[model samples]
Target chain A: MKNQTVLFRSPVPVAETATIAGPKEKEGPLHAYFHYTLEDDLLKQDSHEHAEIRLHVGVLKQLLNRAKLSPQEIDCAFAGDLLDEIIGSNFAMRELDIPFFGIYNACATFGESLILGSCMIEGGFAERVTCSVTSHFATAERQYRYPLELGCQRTPLSQWTVTGAGATLLDKNATSKIKITSGTIGKVVDYGIKDANDMGCVMAPAALSTLRTHLQDTGRTVDYYDKIFTGDLGYSGSLLLQKKASETGIILHNHEDCGNLIYNRIAQNVESGGSGACCCGLVFNGYIYDQLQKGRLKKVLLMPTGALLSKTSSLQGESIPAICHAVSVEVIE
Target chain B: MILNKEEQKVYKKEIKDVAPKTKHISTLLRAFFTGGTICCIGQGVNQVLGILLPSLTEEDRGGYTTLLMIFFTGILTAFGVYDHIGNFGGAGSIIPITGFANSIVSQAMEHKREGIIFGICSNMFAIAGPVIVMGITASVVVGIVYLFL
Candidate 1:
């Protein structure tokens, strides 16, 4: 272990992954990669929150079904969401029998869960663990901004929250080429930005900080992996990260953001791009995982970034603090 | 890394430089046309009402026109059309009485799942509450000034 990063002695193998994307996400570029797509975001549920819970539960069940494992066989489940008090994950856990550890790092929750799940296996505490995250557009809008039906225009920098859920089943003894090699836990960085709508500006500093630290700790260069995936930093935020990284002598030519890749920003009418806890979750489990399995991307660093702010905090005019966690997943030759 | 005040200011300036600037001229034009069209519709409604019931006073006609506008806004909100208009029109759609109706109706419809008492009724004014508060305060102030004058 070096600084904030942990290098697993024996890399934890990813056994199976499942993704359930919403109708809007299904229209995106990675539509075919998702395991399942919901025609209706509500999924016949009355509210979006309930629909999110259903999506979360659906992805977990799909993971188990695909891996041929039962809830009893899984040692523990690590999950989180953007809902108030993380009720999406809490209510979904009610239907399952697995031990649950609810985690929250705002939009970077999936990375946190992945790092924590790998740690559990590497520490000899668990044999098989499931990591998952869920986020919904409607639920997030009502909680963070305004009512879903409100007649309001989105700001130029505003990001559309992805309505999706993704689950990854990690096993200690599984024979899988794609493995969690190491992870760098991020520190919360605040630059005193008070604009709630401009989340990209608020989170870019944190993403840059984590990327710099990860590279320094691992003695790696900018060409370390095939690509460095940042979570939910929309088009502008990604540019900001690249520019700031270059100023510090780190060239990020092979950088991609889950937020920018998940949707067709111009066609879909998304101001900047897709965001939320599930932005990276859906993209990784659906698209990136498929690519890795196909040997398209040999080694990659997954950095999920998050703007840690609540409605109360923003309302009280507090500056937004952001965090990012990086996990290196590679195929063992 | 914790940035000092100077660094924070510099970073904020950098963000401002990178963020896409809002097209003020186009937005203003859109708002003008949308708001003008909405007012024209209200006037058309008032004219039709006057032709139908000539006995009604101007005050009554104005009240009925406002009601008709709210009713039309409620329908648009229910069918999820006003939000698109709002997106295009910006403050044009939001500054009119239709905007007020949309704010209330949208909240009511969104919170309908939570039931009537705590959800729809309480949250209907969530967005429009500040406007209502300021409107009443200004009216009270005006009334007091008139009395003293």
Candidate 2:
């Protein structure tokens, strides 16, 4: 099947979850939901790079502890980060003795990792799989945009990079009721957007395309999912998606973006809202997961979007290309 | 999922309305006055240097004033105060020699952990590189034209 949606006959259950965030994120609206929060972005580490590694390790370790399983007991670990070469996930996974699949899909990495992890379990390749992603504001800023010392003023359209990490443990034996039903892998779509500062605008089209495709592939309507969430489209992207989706006659009534959900839009100075790979990771694992566990929410269609632009491409006057992957999770009581 | 040419045209137009728009007139006024104030301060520094170094030539005094501005900007950048000026002043903080110093020193500080040679020295010219390249090129062109004339 070429770019077909995967439907699991035997649903894989979400066994455990953990999220670790920085001080800035802890100050946001979802602060109470995080499993752990750091006092500083650096986490007392010697450098921002080291701090990013600590974020990944912290979430993975916390999830292991919560699940009461050792790292050696896990069948596989799928992880990623928004750094050059995904150094945060790579370096952190070195501490775990389990088989590691280092993945990268920019901000959409969590959705990518989740789909793959579910496939591994459903295919009988692994019994227990851990999926995780990490992103640090300081580290990401230095790599993608500019150096911290320059203190360049961020444009109003710019989305703040989320400083956090999120991990979830999935088991094939139906240990927990929260199960992944289906997923749709996105294709890279470019709409000729050149501005690097307005990432939300660049990514919205991809999000819309994936949303429409996911619904079509699964033979589901907008009402099928209780909540539809996009990764880090922020305020502008979410609005743009709503506008575009309506034009195609598919209205998303219960739609929200992790970028918009992570912070208080009116109170916080997060211009367009939170972004980065960890934006969705933190919100879904922290806020959305809590809502589901409490039986307040049931079916969720989580689509994490990513703009695939490197520093080199953006510098060379290239338009931004984006992708979004959709995964449906339901609490089957 | 790539868009066709027709689809792209529609997206480009739609996105223009979707993206945030900044007011140009206000920003321009702020930049102009801020930049003017910085030049005025440089002139003031030049006058003070002339009084302190009475025997120095006019050319030497001008050179010293530039050095002083660069030094002041570097210190300001280190203290993280220059960023506020840059934010409010726009081009005002960036058009002067101080802005040039800010760029180099700030970049060096940012990459300092990578080591002196690979980190600091290598990144020292990142923001200033294009400016240096164009400046030298323009000078060479003007020099040749003058010679021919």
Which candidate number maximizes TM-score?
Answer: 1
Model 1 steric clash pairs: none
What docking tier does model 2 reach? medium
Summarize candidate 2's per-residue lDDT along A117-211 as a digit string, tens digits. Answer: 99999999999999999999989888988767663556778999999999999988746889999889998999988889888988998888888
Clashing pairs in 2: none
- Give the clash count for model 1: 0
- What is candidate 2's lDDT per residue for B1-149, written digit by digit as tens? 66778988888888778766766788788888978988999999999988988999999989999999899888988898887778777776787888888889889878988999999999899999999999999999999999999
Position A56, candidate 1: lDDT: 88
Top candidate when judged by DockQ against the true structure: 1
lDDT (0 to 1) per candidate: 0.94, 0.89
DockQ of each: 0.80, 0.56
Please list the residue runs of candidate 1 whose C-alpha ends up more than 4 Å from where it truly belongs after superposition: none
Q: Give the residue spans of candidate 2 off by over 4 A.
A: A1-3
